[model samples]
Target: MDEWVERALARFPNVPALFGWLGLDRRGHWLIQGERISHARIVETIARNYGVDDHGRWFFQNGPQRGYIALEYTPLIASVQADDTLMAHTGRAIESVSALYLDEDSTAVLDTPDGAALVQGADLAWVLDRLRADDSDKEIDDQALSNALAVPSGTQTDLTLVVGNDRLPVYRCDRADIPATLGFVQAPEPRDGENSN
Candidate 1:
């Protein structure tokens, strides 16, 4: 087990941990001990307590057990900003959890649930700001935007294409959800003029 997973297990005993590519299961569910929990339930819980957006995506920290969960999303090429309220809410959630592992004294430090030093006086705002900036949206064409919008809805559509150095996929998923084991190959280009070429 990763040391972070161990630490998280020790600290948050009630919380179940799981790690896999593709964010939550495609069916949007999680299994804990022998019981099952829906991803919608988790999102509801987080939203009710921490104020995440209904349509927003979440990034669960990767480890043998769950580490810290970051509620954010990659921007679609069309939109250049994440919901600001969602970003703030995520920062607050991190702050609350970090407080559980950190101490009050300026110099005091504790091991984070993920085993990193939960140093006192760290600027969480700065971290949140950086994350928000990293998730800043971009401009994409109409087709790309349409493809991205279709993914979460479970529509089977061609949303990605490789052109030169660009590996463009229209979906906005948690980065961790991308499978490392999978490799993409370019499709053969169509020959001139003939529609069936």
Candidate 2:
């Protein structure tokens, strides 16, 4: 959150929070009422102000009002940078990745510094290239990949992803279990007794 936004919140402490007006798409695009936000400055500002609440709901603190974002997928979309580094859709650089998983949808979900992030669909190829046999530099074959995906969700597989100088074990995760496991709400709504208007 920005310093000015904090001051605004202090000045108008009773400003009502807004919901259902903001959303984040699978590709990391910001949406408003189902429409994409095209303005670069506005998008950047929202990204800068975005944060998660205690209830695991992600929101953008817009000056004095907090607007909860409806996420289409994971909270952040991870993109492979030219230098092979990872960056979140919110423009935050992923300094480190602690965990890795291949979801039922074949998308890579990573536990990054920002939070749990789904690798951008466009970067799946890059991820595939980095996948290796468990604890080995050998690239995994298609049959081995299939075998890994056959395991039940939440089970650690015999696969690993080569990230920079680290090799992180890969787990098989179901898409449905991602939210609870990652602790993020895909569709954020007001909690009991909270104002919906």
Report backbone clashes per prediction: 5, 0
Encode model 1's per-residue lDDT on 48-84: one tens digit a residue: 3321112222323333233222211211001112442
Candidate 2's C-alpha runs over 4 A off are: none
For model 2, the run of ten residues with the poorest summed lDDT? 188-197
Model 1 has a clash total of: 5
Compose the digit string of candidate 2's lDDT tens values, residues 1-197: 89999999999988778998999999999999999999999999999999999988999999999999999888899898999888899888989887888888787899876778988888888888889886777788999899989999999898888878888888999998888888899999889887666
- Candidate 2 yields a Cα-based lDDT of 0.89
Q: What lDDT does candidate 1 reach at residue 141?
A: 48
Candidate 1 achieves a global lDDT of 0.27
Error of 2 at 83 (Å): 1.4
TM-score of 1: 0.19
